[model samples]
Target: MAEPRLGQMNASFGEGSVVLRWWEWGPADGLPVVCVHGLTRNGRDFDVLARDLAARGRRVLCVDVPGRGVSGWLPRPELYAVPVYAQCLAPLVAALGRHDWVGTSMGGLIGMAMAALPHATMRRFVVNDIGPFVPAAAIGRIQAYMAGAPTEFADAAALEAYLRRVHAPFGALSDAEWAHLARHSARVAPDGRTVLHYDPAIGGPMMAGDPADIELWPLWEAASARPTLVLRGEASDLLLPETAVRMAARVRVETIPGCGHAPALMEASQVALVADFLS
Candidate 1:
């Protein structure tokens, strides 16, 4: 099969004066499929899936959330919460016209909020490895990781090692895949040290928030106007099986066996499921 067309990287200002970056692919006027990444992740996380969808003639857009990837860092770290994230996304979704959304983790939460709005423009929604109720244990794990995340690496090898250790939940990615991830995840500083792409302070708000007090069941329930699909990793601690079952009551649910916190849609079968559902 021919590879999908990759569009030039584009930038636009978002909430809090942050500049958001995104890449477009496939047809210029095809149905839009906005792909959002997880907390601490960038738009490049969706490259594999985006290319797959684009090859099928969908206009796929993968964006970097504020304070992450190539997007501008927030002036105040307190603005890193979901409400702000959702607000930042609203304009982007509006600009794209009616579309589909595929979000992972924090991105899923933002999508849920947007889809629940009284005048949502989403035609279909997919939540990947996240739900209304996020387990405290998962939150704790994420908090610990973000708190102590490495800022500098001596070389590419070191960065790869760190990513493999921290992102193992993404499951058995190949060395080439890891290289692709590392390419977008790190940037060399003026002093020649390689650092992760996102602002380290982005974790400030997350560390201060009590996970138990963060509830979004109302948003999830209100977003039921459109057909939804929930993708869960069978062993995900973030999206509990029970919670997935509850969400399944109103939407389609697909569990990827042998996976952990998230299913990286790098595999053909996984991409096929997402493409088919969006179509």
Candidate 2:
């Protein structure tokens, strides 16, 4: 019933090194479940889901992808692409030996890439509110917002309000849940104004690339070998319903009603869906 323990693992990427900060819960030798957060989010986002799974005797590991949260920002910001993210996961996955994966948004994309690899170790794959074929509209929205996000907030209260307004698509999160999210997503700046936890330059790649040029159908097809599950928001502009249907032709698809863009997976019901899938 205690909160998850915190730790960091190092992953080498060429000459530069990246440290993946993670939160661990449950027994040390329990079944491993790696939970990855979305873009602009940190490992703390999985606190609720990790707690639920850990309570059930699963060793849940939630990671803050490089460039986000407490993880060090990559010196070469160009390495912030999906391929690099997938590469970074290689060592962690190998270390786990055998594990299941639950990823949200950008994290889900990373899972898809990992699944496409020749030596995928994931026993069950759950992609939360994302698919290989993301609509350009969704990418545009993300690009526009991240490209010019305000770095300073008057105070923690102001930051929380801003997060609630921008991330309303995460569905109806309680005030406490929102507060937890804001606390993790923000930190005190050198000038003392609260700012988002991630490096602002992390948005550069997205802003520079055209969504039309990004394709992942081959990766999706490559993932057909696994028992994959796709969680889509009913009103999501990111993962189209058609794409979900196509994915369902080879895997399982679950639509979270009244949700759009993404589901935070913080609620008990949402956590239950993942628990059942991975169980």
Candidate 3:
């Protein structure tokens, strides 16, 4: 199917001085579905899923959370916590007028917080590969990659190489898919070197201990007012299959085999599963 009908708009947070970017697509008034990306990943991570959902008649709201994608780097990366992001997203959702949410990794955590707030707007919640209490081993693995990634590259080819090495979850992409990812991940710097699109500090908060043994259940439990969908990668170390199954609250759960951390949700079967769940 074709990509979704798309457009961009600036979403303001912390006054007019700091404006983040937001993207909207599909029917302007269709049921809204907010698709959030992972920590290191930007909103484009949801492109495949967004287009699919829109094609099936849903408006998709994908965003560049502070330091990623076309969005600008934060003046202070420490402000990279979910609380800051949720504050920014509240207005964006209000502007949307209506919607549901589908978050992946970091995005999932943010959605959980939104669902838990006193008067949340989340019509439905779909968390892809994350839980209230992530495994320490998984956090370690993600930090290792996020700690120091190449910001400069000789060409898009080199950038694609990094994505393949680091984001193996996409696993054996076609040439075009590789190119698509590279184009979204890098910028042709003024000096001609390719640079990553997000702030390096994006890994900051994730590395900080949240001061709790398990911090997700309260938020997940708050989602009781809305139906929830949790997707897990069967072989994912970041989100252990057993833990994901256990997080299965008063909601639905599914797992994709042969994938880790995330399922691309690009294939027809995966799309069918998500679409059916949302419906």
Among all candidates shown, the one with the greatest TM-score: 2
Clashing pairs in 1: none
lDDT leaderboard ranking: 2, 1, 3
Off by over 4 Å in 1: 1-15, 209-213
lDDT of 2 by residue, 1-279 (tens): 777788788888776688878888999999899999888888999999998898889999898889898887888767888888887778988999889999999989889888888978889999998887877888888987786678788888888988898899999999999999998888887878789999887765777867553468888888767787889999998899988998899899999987887898987788999999899
Error of 3 at 254 (Å): 0.7
Every model: Cα RMSD to truth? 2.4, 1.3, 2.5
On lDDT, the candidate that comes out on top is: 2
lDDT (tens digit, per residue) of candidate 3 on 205-279:
676763223457666777655888888888777777667667775667788776777776766677777777777
159, model 2: CA deviation in Å?
0.8
lDDT of 1 by residue, 1-279 (tens): 344343332333353356666777778888999999998888888888988888888898888888887677777778887778777777778888899999988888889988988888999998999988887888888888888888799888888888888888887788899898888888888888899988887876778866543557888899856999899998899999889899999999999876787888887788889989998
C-alpha root-mean-square deviation, candidate 3: 2.5
Global lDDT of model 1: 0.83
Count of steric clashes across candidates, in order: 0, 0, 1
TM-score of 3: 0.90
lDDT of each: 0.83, 0.86, 0.76
Can you list the residue pairs that collide in candidate 2? none
